[model samples]
Structures are given as structure tokens and as C-alpha cells.
Target: MNFKYVSYLWDEAKAKSLGNNQVDLLIYRSNLLGADLRLTNYGGGNTSCKTTEKHPLTNEPTEVMWVKGSGGDLGTLKKSGLAALYMDRLLDLKKIYRGLQYEDEMVELFNHCIYDLNSKAPSIDTPLHAFLPFKHIDHLHPDAVIAIAASKDGKAINQELFEGKLGWVDWQRPGFDLGLKLADCLAQNPDIKGIILGQHGLFTWGDEAYSSYLNTLEVIEKASEYLASNEGKRRPVFGGVKIQALEKEQRLTQASKLAPILRGLCSSYQQMVGHFTDDERVLQFVNSNDLDKLAPLGTSCPDHFLRTKIRPLVLELAPDEDITDYKKIKEKLIPAFEEYRKGYTAYYEQCKHPNSPKIRDTNPVVILWKGVGMFTFAKDKQTARVASEFYINAINVMRGAEAISEYISLALQEAFNIEYWLLEEAKLQRMPKEKPLSRKVALITGSAGGIGKAIAKKFVQEGACVVLCDNDADRLKGAEEEFEKTYGKDSFSSNVVDVTDNQSIAKLYQTACLAFGGVDIIVNSAGISISRTIEETKESEWDLMYDILVKGQFLISQQGVEILRKQGLGGDIVNIVSKNALVSGPNNAGYGSAKAAQLHLSRLLAAELGKDKIRVNSVNPDAVIADSKIWAGAWAEGRAKAYGVTVEELPKFYASRTLLNEIILPEDIANGVFACVGGLLNKSTGNVINVDGGLAAAFVR
Candidate 1:
């Protein structure tokens, strides 16, 4: 809302218009907006501008819009940082809204205007911009406006305050219909300067860039002023309901019921919104009368559905209720949620048109009526931030509108119609997947020696940041030093991790995500050996082997896959399996079973993650002597002694047993990991690649 910053950005964006194909401006705007986004946390909005110019070589005119892509906030939008969008096509598609079927047709229509083939789908609200009559548009759900929107009669209240100053639309399901509605509104009010989408957000425009940008501040200030001067009688009768008085027991009960479903839908929402209740102002607001009415305004924008789903939780508290029974309270709340889900299903079925996609889940985005405040869910930090902002603003806007008349929601069926509407779903399902990580971050576990170290080095050679993790801290440190000295680039990092511990694995992934933005490739090369027959293998040894191989792989893969889902980039995970997994190995029940479990886990993950563009596969290597720590250890050494051969001769003995008599090095296994990157084997996930030196007849079964 700062005029100076807006002016500065407008000038800079105008200045950066001379180049063909540059991401600098897009990145700059993303950071600028990102700051505002982080501060407001949930109501952070974005902007984009379209321009058409003649190509220098072809003499043909192409269009591009400077869009605010992922990864940056809007409070600090800079020129050269917005995503360059093809403009003419966007404009062309903007005019074609006829005869489109639901999901499939919608997805097919979205393909008409393509931006970066390397990034995820364009923002869900891109369609909003597609129909904007203006070249430059700024959208936001500032807290000042949202606080008013949260009221029970938000629509009526906002209408009275703005009173002919802004164009208002009841919250339409924000897609093609919203765009068409906006286009109609613009047509009616040739002089209609700005638009305020009820229960949704604010859209500002300009003939000259600054006019629209400045208008946003001007209109928001007007609404803020109206609320300031006419806030009505200060109802302090509920002042006795202090933060401590808002049952600590009831709060936990509500969180438990809502967290899992919300978490499953969008994993990061609980963490972000939970922090607000800790603040005194938010807690006081929740304790006040406004709490009950404002809890169900939904999100400030439709896209918020992606993060927080649709609604937040509402909890009803009685003055004398014993607040100490948290667990008992949660037990009772489950049935209420079940009832809500049932009601929701009926609503969806009744209201949805024949052209909508089937509902994906029964969970409500928001919780209500149980003495608990709202909770938003999201897949990542950014999504959660957006959800919280939208929730906060919608509440404020609802409150402001309540002074005039009753607030109206689109009929449940209509909402269901919009939510499950095929066109809307197709936008998400048909998005083209990209592989930027063919050159991004690579994480190699057990990278001190063998295939792990090779993969780690391979990533470094191919323009990627590498993290080397292993149980042997010293060797990992050594590899780190060698990487730093050899390349003299600070592109390699190391972590000493015991992957068997769930907590440790979680922390390791957190570290990886924080340090390198995100992890794109994960190679599990850490394993253990007992080398005893089933009866001879001690219980303790069997436990240790399973812990290192099966449990370690499970935890590591889980953590890695979660982070990859959030990064919005194509991700790859490679498991190091033994040929023994495919063919039974003698005296190796525990090890074989554990490895087989790992292979199966990889396959399952591949299926689950294919939608997320994450690939999971394993390399099955046989008789590789390059980094055979098992052979150097007690069991293999003892076996060598018993066979009357030195430890060095063990390599020859294993190689001669193979059909080709060839020795495979750790580097060979590393190459298999590298192949998974760059999208080279994109279509080949779930299958195990044989990286053995050719041993057929001797294969144990």
C-alpha cells in the first residue's frame, strides 16, 4: 500500500521492457511481492502486465505478460522478476469461452496460452488476468479490507462504505465465470475504476500504470477510513472472555480433529495459522462476539482452496464448561465432523452439474462450532501463508458488510458446482510437468564411498548443488573437503545422519530444504551387513540390519518425497538395491527381506508421486567391488581367511564367479543415479535397473 514503492516498481518495470526472454524482472517482482506476502502472511496478493512487440528476427509480433510466478512475495515486486507470459495468446483465449466442456475441455483450453514449460502451471488466478481489460492489474486482499469482510454482513457493509466508488460482485467461483462477470462489470462502468470481489478480493487497474497502483492504496485507505470513523458502539460486554478464559483444553481438542484432514489436504496450514492464536490480539478477537459470525467466510480468494481448502474450523465455548478435559472433548468432536462431511456430500451431489469432476476428499478446509478458532491447511510454507491472509481478509470484509444486511453465500450446490466444476479441476490436472532439477540439488546418503560418493560427484559435475550424507561422519567430512578443494566451489555440503531415526530423518530433510531451497534428487546408498544364515543371524543383528536398510530407507524416502512435493519441481529418488533382492541369496534372509521391502516401497512411492512429477526407482547392482566395505569388515574378512585367500583376492574371486568376469566400480552405480536426472528416463520409474557386471548362471534363487 506504499505509494512510493508502487511508483518505484512501475518505473522499473517500464524500464525493463526492452529485452526478449529474461527472468530478472520476474524474480525481482516475486521478491518484492514476497516481502508483502510474508508480512501480511495470508492476504499477500500479486500483479502482472501484458505487452506486445515485434520480434527482432522474425518481424512477427509476440505478446508477453510479466506474471508473478512462484517463489517470491508481492510487497516487493521488482521489474525483470515477473514470469514472461505470451500475451497475444492470452488475449486471444480471453475471448474464447464458448462450448467448452468441464474438466477435460477446461484443461484443453488452458493449453492455448503457455508460459514457462520448465515451471509448474501458471497461477490458478491467471484466468482472472486473462479477461482483465487493462494491461496492468494489481490484486490484493489487504488485512484492512479483510477485517471488515469477516463480519457476518460483509457484502452489505462493504457496499455501503464503498457506495458507488467500487464495483462489487458476490463471491463467484473464481474461474471463467468470474472472468466473464468481471468483463461485464468493466463494460458497464466505463469509468468504474476498481473492483471489490465480495468474500474474495480487490482488483485495481490503470490506463497509466501508476493510476491503477495508486488507486489500490486510495480505495483501501477509503475503506480503512470508513471503518475508523464509523466502527459503531464498542461492545465490551464480552471483555471478560480473556485469552486464558478461552479453554486451553478445548483448543487442543479442536486442533486434533482438524489437523489430520487439513494436513492431508495441505500439509503446512496448521503450523502457520496456529501461530496467530498465540498472539493476544487474535486471541481476543476470537473471544469476542465477532468470532462466531466471521468463522465461515471461506478464503479471500478461490485459489486459497489449494492451500486451506474451503473453510476454517469454528468452536463454540460455554462460559462454565470445564475446560480441562481436552482428550474427552476431541472424542466428542469427531462425530460432529462426520456429520458435517455427510452434509457436505449431499450439498455437492445436489449442486454439482454433470460437467464437474468428482469430489477428491470429504474434509472441510475450515472447522466450525466447537469452541475452537479457524485452522487452514496447505502443502507448504507459501501456500499456508496465502491461505491465512485470505482467511483473515475474508473475515474482516464479512464484518464490515454485516452492518448493512445479512451476508449471503453462493448456495451450497452452486459452491459445489464451482468447486467440482470440470473446468476448474482441469486447470490443476492438465498442467504440464517440467524438469528443472535435471540441474538443481542432489542429495546422496552414504556418500563417503561406493555408489553414494560417485553420485554425489556426478551431480557436482552437472551443475547441481550436492549434499553428502552418511553414517560415517569422518569419511563424509573427507568427501566434503575433497569436493571443495577439487572444484574450489562451495556447491557441496555434508551431513552426518543416522537415517534409522524418524526424528533424525525429518531434521535431515528440513536442513536440506532450508539450505538448498529444496532437494531434487535423493540417493539412498547406506546399508548394513550381518552375513549369517537365518538361524545363525542373531536377533540383535537382524534388528540392526533392518533398521539400517528397511527403516532407514523408509524414513529417508518419506522425508525426501514430502519436501519434493512442496518444491513444485520434478524430483527423483533412487534406491540402492542388491541383485539379491530379485534372486534369493543364501544365508541372507533379513538383509534380503529388508532390501525387497525397500524396492517395493520405491514402487509404491513412484505411483503416489507421479502426480507430483516425482520419480522413484532403484538400481540393482551385483558383485560390485569398488567400495565393498562389507568385504573389508569382519564377516567378509573372516570368510576370506577361511577360504585361504587375502581380502584383496576376494574381488577376483567374486569377479571370476560372474559370467563376464568383469569388476564394476562404485562409479558405475553413480551413473545410474545420474540417468534419473535431466528427465532422461522420465518414463521409466518403478522398475529396477540392473547395474551388475554380468553374473547369470551363478545368480542365487
Candidate 2:
């Protein structure tokens, strides 16, 4: 069959290479299936296989069910992530089942069924995967199949689309009960290869891993073809588009202005990072006539709404107004967000369980604007990006459902129940605590340089999203690639910026806004130095030093402040100053004076911006010899000449002069910067930290 929507990536040789290890083949099948979002979204769905393993205690072959554990993504799953439980013990859970009220209790009981004290917790759908008769099983939320599942006539459609080979089960919140019903459905239609769970997703199974994977592909492919065939008809989607999307540049430009405002308002309850997109499907949905009608219905898939929340808050401007008018958009977003909060609180009041987790973060995770795009805000960058993707999956479900029949949203009560489920609350409690800078976004100028790169890496390690800005495009690209491999593409973004130029600085902040909502930290580490005597300092040399060290920092800070105030989130600004700024040094007239200017500027800004809660601090380091760009050229030779020492002995000379006799390094400078903003110094600002191995003269008075 010619497959249009999904890619069949199964390699026969690769499957054979796994040999006879059942769990290994299951993992292979899982990775292949999960490589495409068409099969399942990130961290969505679960796969399982029944295997015979020698018991850790008894040393006897035992039937252990190995299923994808809670919070594990199929694409990245390993043996450690699979929960192993005794089959007989898991099935024995049925004997004591006291009905739906005790469903959550069943999850707790699953702990008692572990085969060999496996630490990975089983998902709530453990019964669904465990009780299934097949040795291998696949459960996925493929957009094509979910569209059919979320349709008004999903059950009848599922049977018709796959003929007698596929069976249907009504939507029941996934639990021990739903698991029992799924098994019953298959039992009733013994010849069917899979069952479509209404308003949920697809389930396919076979005796082996390869067969199960193929069965899943077969089901989703058929659904895609069916949806594709109908999409060719006129007015096939949401009653056709009422407004065409803006040009790509116009859309993102408007998004940049709109994103910070939305991020700020949504972050009132808690800080959030943001993501933006204008994919074709998103534009088709948001710009449609039926958007107003369809949007409030909410997403149907459990996994979709889990991250995106039940319904997205739709935002749009009047036809008469200009989308580029940032001021006007800001005015609209504030009250709309307030109203959204009120509605959300009311939703809680209406449907909340008596023991529900305290109404979590009333902020809407997903926000939609007509003719613009979708913006999602979450605690961190990856979560924000994943939430956007999930909502897009929701849009796909909506499209397929609406094209063939009326889309059926899950009942608000069910959405509420799932959102407030105790099991989910426990899961959240188990999550590791947020790192120091987790939700913060920091923009570090001269990030390709040693000290700047160290600061950027530290911030990312502490969980802040960083924007790496520098005039050197090649170095900036290399820095981003290095960060991408380690911290991932979301942890940092790179921009080629000449900090001395006002327009260049402006665009850099704009990129920060579009990339990660708004800036929470500003690091002005870009620098240059000339170690010439006052008499030898040329006019051009002095001007160049001041341009980069003084004017450059001012312009970058000016732009960053605008965004910080817009976000209404207090921010941090760390200026990389020099010990020369404090202690007078010979042959350093230009460099020393410029450093003094940057040092004083930080203090002045701290005093003036106190009301705005923007803290400004300086990290003064005398000799950051290791990995520092400032020490790589003429400055080293010139300083060495002034000290009457060889360039190679400069580090020792500086270290010997200090009371502690310790050599200063770039990472030490980075540590000082992080100390200023890493929650430890929230109440302290305008202070200068001397990272020159205890140099008395450079210490702030």
C-alpha cells in the first residue's frame, strides 16, 4: 500500500539483529514507532511486552509484564524505564476490585505486584496493558486515528473503516475498569486485531513485537487515507478559512510583541517560558469562522489536554486595529487574561473534587490568536514547546473529527477529574524540584567568549534558558551547536549581535522575546581592552574602548530593560567589570577608564531601577587568564610590558600579588555572576564581587 501520512521505518535486518530478546525487540519496535509524531507525541502512550525472566529472589522463570513506566517517552525509553510486574499478581488485582471509586487505590496496589522490586512506577493504564491477552501490545495517540476516535460517530466509524478487523470501546477514564472493558471488547470480537478507545486513541496487538508494530501501522494508515480522501471536498475544514494568515514575517513580528505580554500575564501566578508557532493547521483552525465555536469545546485526547489544559484561551484583535501596535495588544491581553482567570476559577468551583489538588496554576497553558499563531507558556522551555506540539495534535484531531462528523469534546467533568486526579498529583509530587534558574530566561552578550560562555553554560545548568549573543557568527554557531548537544536546542539560542550598534542590540532582545517569552536575566559580558599608557593611547583607541565597554553595555541594557519592565518580572543584570576599574594601574588608561565607567553604570542603574526590582551588579576579576578572550591578545602583552614581566608569567604575577595567591579563571568569574542572581542575592544588588583571588584593592568599599 502507498502510505501518504505515516512512514514505515521498520528494518527487517535491524529487527533480526535484536535476536531473541523479547524486551529488546519491544524497545526496538517502540523507538521505530515513536520516531514520528504521527504515531505518538512526546511522552504520550505506552508499549508493553510479556517476558519470562528468572526471578531475582526465587531464580525461577516467571511471567513478568514489562510496560512503559509512568513519565517515560517511547523514543527515549530504555530497560530501566520499563516497569516489571508479576502477571499473576497484576491480574489478581481483579479479585479485590471494589469498582470505580477504588480505581486510584488499584494504582497503589500495583506496587505490591512488582516482580523484583522494580523502582519504575507503573502508569495508571497498567491494567489496560497487563490484562490484554496478547504478549505484545501498542497504545498510541496517533493524530489520524485520534481524529476518528474523537469524532461523534467514532465507534461506528472505527468498525466501518477497518471492517470486522477493528473493534470499538466507549470512552471511560483509563483505569482498571477501562482495562477490563478493553479486554471484553476484544473477547467479543475475537478476530479483530485492535480496538479504538472512543475519544482516546488506538490499541493494536500481536503475538510478537514486530507483528504488533505492523498492526499499529496498518490501523493508523487506513485512518489517514480515510481522512485524506474526505479533505479534498469543498469546505472540508471548519467551514473554510475566514481570515488568511499574515505573511510569515508579519506573523512572527506580531508574535514577538504579543508573546511577552501573554507570558507576563500568564506568569503572574508562576514564572513561565514561552514557545510560538504558525503551522498551516494552526492557522487554518485559528483563522476559521468556526474557531469561536470549536475552541471552547476543548481538546478530546487525555494526553493532549493534560499539558495544554482543557480549553485554550483564544485571543484576537479587531479587524480595524493594527496587530503591530504592541501597546494596544498589551492593553487587550491584561484584561483578557484576568477574565480567563475568573472563568478558570469558576470552572474549578463547578467541577472540582472535594479532595482535588489545590486549583493548580490558573494560567492558561495554550493561547490562540486569529491570523497570528499559537503561544504556549509553561514552567520551562521544553515543557512550553511540548505543550504547543500537543495542542497542534489537538488541532489535527479537531480537523479530522469536524471533516467527517461533529467533533466530540470530552465532558468537562471528566477533564476536571483527570486534571485533579490524585494519581497525577502524586506524580507531580515525585518530580524533582525546579533548579535555581529553571523558568528564567537570560541573555548573555559576548557569549562566545570564555567568561561569557562559562556564565551562559552555568545559567543553562541551573535551568535558565540562555540567549548567546556575539558579533562573531561562526563562534556563536559553534557555541550553539555545543549547547544543543548537551543541554538541548531549547536551553539556549544564538544571535550574531554587534553590541555597540543600537539596532543590533534591539534585534537581539527581540530574538530573546520571540525565543523564550521575555528576559529574566541580562548578562553584559562583552568586552575589549587596550593596555597603552595615557601618552600613547590614540584617540581612536580610546573611542573604540568606550564604544564597546561603555556604550555597548548601555544599549544592550536599555533594550533588555524595556522587555523586563514589559514582563513585569524583576530581573538581573551582571556587568563583567575589571579590577582595573577599582585599583589604579599604569599603562591602562583607556581600558581602566572604560571599566570604571561600566562599574559605575551598574551601580547607578541599581539605584534608579530599585523600584522596578531590576538588580544590577558587577563581577570584577583582575586576571581571568584561562579561556578569557581579553587575555588572548595585545592586552596580555601590553600589560606584561607594563609589569616588566614576560607575557607567560602574567598569571603568576597577578596571583602572587593577591593575598590568597590563587589564580583567577573564567569559571570563577561565572560563579560570581551566578551568586548575584541565583536566588541567594535576591535582596542584594549594586555590589561588586572581587574575583581576583582576594585582591584587597579591588574589593568593594
Clashes of each: 72, 0
For residue 334, give model 2's deviation from the true position in Å: 2.2
My TM-score estimates for the predictions, one after another, are: 0.53, 0.98
Per-residue lDDT of 1-701 in model 1, one digit per residue for the tens?
A: 35421222345555357343333433443344345531134324667666665654686888666666443356555543345556666666645556323323443555456654443345545667767767667777654555454445665666677776677776665556676678788787767777877655678776545565557667767766665555453443222354343466555443433333233332221221111222333455466665555445444444344445555555444523453443454455556556656766776677766656775656555433334444543322233334555555444444444433334434455455556756557655754552334236677788887778888877776656777888887887788788889854346656789989876665565455433445678888888766666677788988998888888888888877655654445578899988777767666787778888888888898898888888888888865666656656775764465456787787787677677787778888878777766557877778777677776732433
- Per-residue lDDT tens digits for candidate 2, residues 372-406, read 88889999889999999999999999888887777
Q: What TM-score would candidate 1 get against the native?
A: 0.53
Which residue window of length 10 is worst by lDDT in model 2?
Answer: 318-327
